[model samples]
Target: MTAARTEQAPGTRAPDAPENDVVLRLEDLVVEFPAGGGQTVHAVSGISLEVRRGETLGLVGESGCGKSTTGRAIMQLPRPTGGAVVFEGRDITKLSAAELRETRPKLQMIFQDPISSLNPRRRIPDIVGDPLVVWGRRDERAKVVPEVLTAVGLDPEQVADRRPHQFSGGQCQRVSIARALVLEPEVLICDEPVSALDVSVQAQILNLLEDMKARYGLTLVFIAHDLGVVRNISDRVAVMYLGKICELGETEELFDDPVHPYTRLLVSSIPSMETVTGADIEKADRGRGEMPSPVNPPSGCRFRTRCPLATERCAAEVPEMREVRPGRFAACHYPMLEPVGAGAAVEGA
Candidate 1:
């Protein structure tokens, strides 16, 4: 959304991207699970995308929609069964132990749970400094830990000696971030970074990430299920359903004019702003039904089972990604983006 120039739908170049800024590119990425019955769950179906240097790309979808799996595949934390994860022009899917170790300094992950991600046995300083130590910066870690701690809104002097249980959830997440960032990674894959925190704490952490992005020139792969949060942070957003990308565009464009039926439903599903909102616990689950199981997702367009606009064709054929306009992509046999000045609905959407 950073004033990026438009090419065909799903533009190849970014708006306001610096000459040397583009960082991570995920091309034809597929993540699958092999089961005993010769049944494979294609968790992430051949999705291609690019994350520019200093840009935040959001991957939003339902819980079982492979958002987290995509992040895991990028980090190769859980071995990816197929597809390529390219970082700075290198395909990491084929790297060996030593090669992965060399690459680790530039790629890092901030996990979803703050409390669980940190080890209860480790003190704050040791936890934050672990990345530095692993990267052979032990001597310099002394100077770096305090700086990193302070950067993440933590007090180095008072909390340095405490274990994970000593601090609150928000503080633990900050510690986790400090740990991931201490080594100065170029690309950080945040797997639902704010999903586990209290809303206030979530805001604090989000602000920290924004600041860190500016200071460190970080390329962020932010994964989450919330639309408002994605709108606030991402330059580009890709909406997924049942393991495949349903829509992709700059944040403002996608939200302002969603081109896919599934996307419109997602936008419509955002908690209506003026209503006496449901209790915080139930708000996110209010309008949506249980997400369909991925093990045997609906055929053709996996979302057809839940799609209000689904037709016979939707259940029988996989729609191709079509360029609906300047810099937007939608996978739909009947791309239902509301035409400019026309009815506020796209075909079958």
Candidate 2:
């Protein structure tokens, strides 16, 4: 179900965000598609978020939870069904096709399957330099393409003539990254860029991304199901469930003290040697059921079906995103670490 928005939401900027520093803001973003038979796949429900300049905002959630959809929506991949995507203070969602082409250079993306994303029929240089050619900057191809290739740790001299199939998966990802950086984008959206790589290669790619971020002054929207990876790179984290954000806060703050039951379950799911909290275990256990179909999502809170603390109010009224602490926000009528009052948990729930 789509959660209701409060005054704090749609206007809920990241805690560390300064009014003038937000590079991208999503206002009630929604993306849906026909599922046939008069049903619709609620890919991304009404959700609002802000990406601050020079900060990595990690979007973490389980598979099919809309993290990747949200990332693609920011790029206007299919043009969201609703809402505005404001980039650099202008609503690009309203921009004309030609206008969008002019604005696209400042925003780039690295896909999950690096090898598949790169065209096998094209040579490395052609693949990486294609952006320059497309944007009418072909004159700068020889200069900028090699520069980005070197920046991403690939020797243009060696790999430039080779095809995408010649390099390993990790190398192809580096190529994808180089292609994204070739245009010198101000914002980079990484859609699970490392999920298809080896554990060892994941670290290398992660390190490279951080290095690139610092060297190029790029804002990032890192979408992944791996909380460990998100914790290492993100300044702030937004936990999504179904199609909405359940919690958002500083990386460490949210990881250490998750407020939403869904967030707690995600943390508990991570393999840990340290003791897990009783509350976290309980939340995780309660959240064991299969996720409800997005086409016919549960009423009120989307997570209520699996949330053990759900009550009648949870079924009747949509939870609004609200600050449960100084800076942390959660969209649950009965947030964790708070006293359960009138919306107390239902018996045997």
Candidate 3:
């Protein structure tokens, strides 16, 4: 999953330098769906971010925030409605099918549910080896399948013969991990890969992902609704609201110094933040409302309705993701970071 230049390049890809360190870049990306009855659903809108070589960039938001669509767009599973997906140096959005076929081997995605994603009728080998079959690399598939199965901690001989239904949720997830690793891809788009599993099983899958990342030199765009899960695994975190990123920064910096009001609320939702020492404490209650339809998002800042700091300016103009710290970015007109153990000071008032 390491997007570490699957092929050698001339320069270093320092994270956040989307043009340089970027293994995958989504620029002003937008995807709209025809919802029928003369309505258009904006699944994603003007979203931009980068996955650096050998780093995990987490995209976190409530469900239906277009995180999954962003992953699908990267794979070009369904044609994107608009915008560009640049992988390596070439823009995959513009590549023809023939070109994309060659690119698919280096980029792959792991689904949230393993049972649905893996064919129930197909045995493990066939299911895990399907990518190779499609691309005419049968030899490599056979050679890598058993090895990856064992690498993900499965008994290759026993499990290889079983159908996906034969395994538990955890084992199936491991198999999905094996399938992803077998390709030895440069980038792995994980769309809530562990969300469906039990809490105990979740840890094993997360550990397996971390191990695989190191072993394969992988880069990742990890998407999830669970902020705690994201903080454990991501190097950088991006907070999305109504199809656009409201904040992004080094995981530690953003968690401790969250500036955006939406981000502050999300942090409060994670119980782990309270138990874990050194994590900033947000004693204030988070605002509540189901996210609005992306079909017709609000004008200016989409999060204005729920943001406590919202002002006439916030609703009248779109705020850019301004650099709040050297590597941290937040989109609020009034940022809300607090000093640790400083009696819960309110900021940007």
**TM-score of every candidate:** 0.88, 0.93, 0.89
Judge candidate 3 at residue 159 and give its lDDT.
77
Writing each residue's lDDT as its tens digit, candidate 1 over 61-152 gives 88889999999998887767766677776778778988987997899999999899998998999989987777678998879999999988
- In order, the Cα lDDT scores of the candidates are 0.79, 0.86, 0.80
What number of backbone clashes does candidate 3 have, counting pairs of residues 3 or more apart or in separate chains? 7
Q: List the residue pairs that clash in candidate 2.
A: none
Using TM-score, give the best candidate's number.
Answer: 2
Weakest 10 consecutive residues, lDDT, candidate 1? Answer: 276-285
Each model's Cα RMSD: 5.5, 4.2, 4.8
* TM-score for predicted model 3 compared with the true structure: 0.89
The C-alpha stretches of model 2 lying farther than 4 A from their native spots are 1-11, 338-349
Off by over 4 Å in 3: 1-19, 273-286, 337-349
> What is the model-wide C-alpha lDDT for candidate 3?
0.80
How far residue 139's Cα lies from its native spot in candidate 2, in Å, is: 2.2
**Among these predicted structures, which one has the highest lDDT?**
2
TM-score of 1: 0.88
Name the lDDT value of residue 86 in candidate 2: 84
lDDT per residue for candidate 3 within 1-349, as digits (tens), equals 2353243221112334655666887767888899879999999887777678899989999998888988898899886887778888777888899999889889989999987888899899888888777767888876888888888999878976799888999898888888887778999999999999999999999999999999999998899999989999999999988888888888988777676778877876678635422223333343467788988888888888776556788779988767666777777676665654444434455
